[model samples]
Target: MKGISENMYCSDCGKKVKDGADICFNCGKEIPRGINKYITAENLPEEYKPISMWGYFGYQILFAIPIIGWIILIVYAIGGAPNINVRNFARSYFCFYIIAATLLLIVYLS
Candidate 1:
């Protein structure tokens, strides 16, 4: 089996870092405990509104072709958003996609 490397980016600072590194070298941001489990709305800045919402929804509808949608998501995430609810909305949208994908796959393979 081929080993796939998981990329790490600082959750708080958005700086790229080594996967196993304990802290972000770029911004000296401490990696939060259980950072991988939840994405919060408050941390995001105020410039990423329009894209994240559309980009998050696009992920579900365009799951089979993710390249474009992912690009949009990255843009929105990096740009930031003013609304505190935006991130949570996006998070729930992706969560729904997970359930929907599982059901669809089961239906298709049955």
Candidate 2:
């Protein structure tokens, strides 16, 4: 009967979790050794720090503009962006734009 635990405990909330579970059902927090590797602030590299909230908002505002926004989007989407996160965001943004345009066109034609 040794090493035959029926359940596990959440380290943060001390709530009981099912054995072999990757998240705490009660707290909804990812358990250690879960599907996604948890990265803490201390573990983050100096160069990989996330952009400030204001900076992200500014990017959003800039992206909402017309001609300049398109130019910036193209630059970011086409590998000219230096930050990987920004590049990925730009690519996804373009994908969203294309999908939205297609949907609108379909609706208009119908």
Best by TM-score: 2
Q: How many steric clashes between backbone atoms does each model show?
A: 2, 0
Clashing pairs in 1: 48-80, 48-81
State the lDDT at 110 in candidate 2.
100
Q: Which ten residues in a row have the lowest lDDT in candidate 2?
A: 34-43
lDDT of 1 by residue, 1-110 (tens): 42345566887777787555556889888777554333345433354344556665655565334777554444434444344355555455556657998999999999
Superposition TM-score, candidate 1 onto the true structure:
0.33
Error of 1 at 103 (Å): 0.9
Total clashes for model 2? 0
> Which residue pairs show collisions in model 2?
none
**Residues 10-107, candidate 2, lDDT per residue (tens digit)?**
88898987655667889888776642234457544444667778867777777778999979988988988767767777888889889999999999
